[model samples]
Target chain A: MKITILYFARIKEVVNYSSEDVVLPEEVETIIALKSWLSGRGATWQKLFDGSGVVRAAINHELVDDMATFDEGDEVAFFPPVTGG
Target chain B: MYLKVSVQPGDFDVGAELQQLRAATPQAGALVNFVGLVRDVSTDGQVSEMVIEHYPGMTEKALQQIAQQAMQRWPLLGIRLIHRVGSLTAQAQIVLVAATSLHRQAAFEACAFMMDYLKTEAPFWKKEVGDFGQHWVEARASDEQAKQQWKLPK
Candidate 1:
């Protein structure tokens, strides 16, 4: 399945890229599954998804927890929890 | 309920907003105003400007949800939530939440409560401009703790 991923706040700065479109394997069930799939790709992806990483997720523009599900044509965002008032 | 999320500039008359709300209804006995300023000191003392980024649609929706929550919680006569995005200087008013209610308690509590939620719940991103370079500040555990009070938040 193909989905567009958005990066924001600190995660955007660390990744050095704001957004991208990627194809994931069918085994990618939930957001946690997607994280594991991405990590195996390389060090850059792996380093960003470590257990201690502070990444928040959203599916299709709605704020969601890590367990959010996804499918083809989904718009998933990975961002740091907002600290601004 | 009124909401304004802009990237243009942070020059608005909050005082006038307060007065207008107060004069609009006789039931309003209290008006509460809060101004969130951009500071040079981050947790790491990152001294400089801040570049704020936001999801145009989602940001508005989240603020609107908060405003609706405020209305549901109290008898607010007027509510204004103004947030300025983009690059901002030190001490600039990044956010303003003005709420008016018939009772002083509800006005102050709801205004303060909305800010507490905004600090963690809003879809805002801030990049610190520093002596070395600009970078996004890390999300902190303290912010999470502060949001715990609103644990039952929808």
Candidate 2:
């Protein structure tokens, strides 16, 4: 399955990218699995999903928990905790 | 109930916005608005400029949901929420939330409710550029505490 991932604010700065489209493996079924897969890519990616940052996730524009599942073509975003007024 | 929610990079004219709402909803006896501004200083002194970023699609949706929640909770005739994103200078307006109702209490409470929700629910981040350097504004635990008060009783 292919999905679009979005990064925002400090996460974008740290990742050095804003958005990307990637094909998910069968093992990457849940958001937690997806994070684990991304973390396996390297150190920088690991730091993002690792317990280090206050990362939050949303699927299809609605905020969700780590265990949330996404379907093919879904848009998933990873961002720092909101600070807007 | 009437609701207007906007998330844009451009500035909004609060007076014009409020005037238009009032013109359209004459039955409303009370009007309340809250405007958030970029401050000149943070914990680190003397801020230069601030950059506000948001998830383009989700920002509007979150504001709409918050405005709808306010309408559901109060007898509001109308509600308008505008949040600005992108580069902003110190003292520039960042957001405006306005509510109208037949009575003062409803309007006041709804406006406050919407703002409190927006602080935590809205998908926006702020980076303050100061003499020390730029840093993303940290989310306040107090903001979460404020929004928690509105959670439906379990």
Candidate 3:
């Protein structure tokens, strides 16, 4: 399935990219699976998804847990916890 | 109910926003407003400026959801939530949240509820630039605890 991924705040600074569209492998169906798959990209990805820090995810503009599943054309976002008032 | 949610890079006029809300909901007897300003001091050192970043589409959606939840939780007649992005200097206004209701209690509680939810749930992040250098502001555990207090009893 093809999906769009967005990085915000410090995550964007670390990844050096704001957004990307990619076709997900069959094994990457859930948010945790996607995180694990992306961590294979490089050191920065590993550092982010290695569970050292709290990273929040949202699917289609709604915050979700790691077990939440997304489908094709969905918009997924990853960022550190929010600090806005 | 009247609801306005905006995510912009420019500053907002709090007085004008409040006037508009009051005009729209003439029946409301209480109008509560909260303005958040960028502090000049931080834990590291004197802060010069803050750079705020937010997810374009999601920020507005999350704010609207928060406002809607506030409306449901209280008898609110109108709500206005505006958050500014981009680089902002110390003492500049960063956010405005206003709630109007027929009574003071509902308006006061709703205003605080919306702010608590916005702090933890909104996608905006702040990067503080000070004498110590730039660093992303960490989310406060106190904010999470404040939001949790609003949870309905199971």
True contacts kept of each: 0.71, 0.88, 0.84
DockQ of each: 0.65, 0.91, 0.89
Instruction: Show model 3 residue runs off by greater than 4 Å.
Output: none
> How do all models score by TM-score?
0.87, 0.97, 0.98
Q: Model 2: per-residue lDDT, tens digit, B1-154?
A: 7788888889999999999889878999999999999999999878989999999999999999988888888989998889999999999999999988999999998888888889998899999999979988999999999988878897
Q: Give the 10-residue window scoring lowest on summed lDDT in candidate 3 chain B.
A: B52-61
Better of 1 and 2 by DockQ: 2
Residue-level error in angstroms, candidate 2, position B86: 1.0
Instruction: Quote the TM-score that chain A achieves in each candidate.
Output: 0.87, 0.96, 0.97
Q: Identify the superior model by lDDT, candidate 1 or candidate 2.
A: 2
Q: B1-154 in candidate 3: lDDT tens per residue?
A: 9999999989999889999999999999999999999999999999999999988888999999999999888999999999999999999999999999999999999989999999999999999999999999999999999999999999
Q: What are the clashing pairs of model 3? A: none
Poorly placed runs, candidate 1 (over 4 Å): B1-10, B23-26, B43-46, B152-154
Model 1: how far residue B38 lies from native, Å: 1.6
lDDT of 1 by residue, A1-85 (tens): 8998888876777778899998887888588888888788788888889967677888877788778799899988888778677
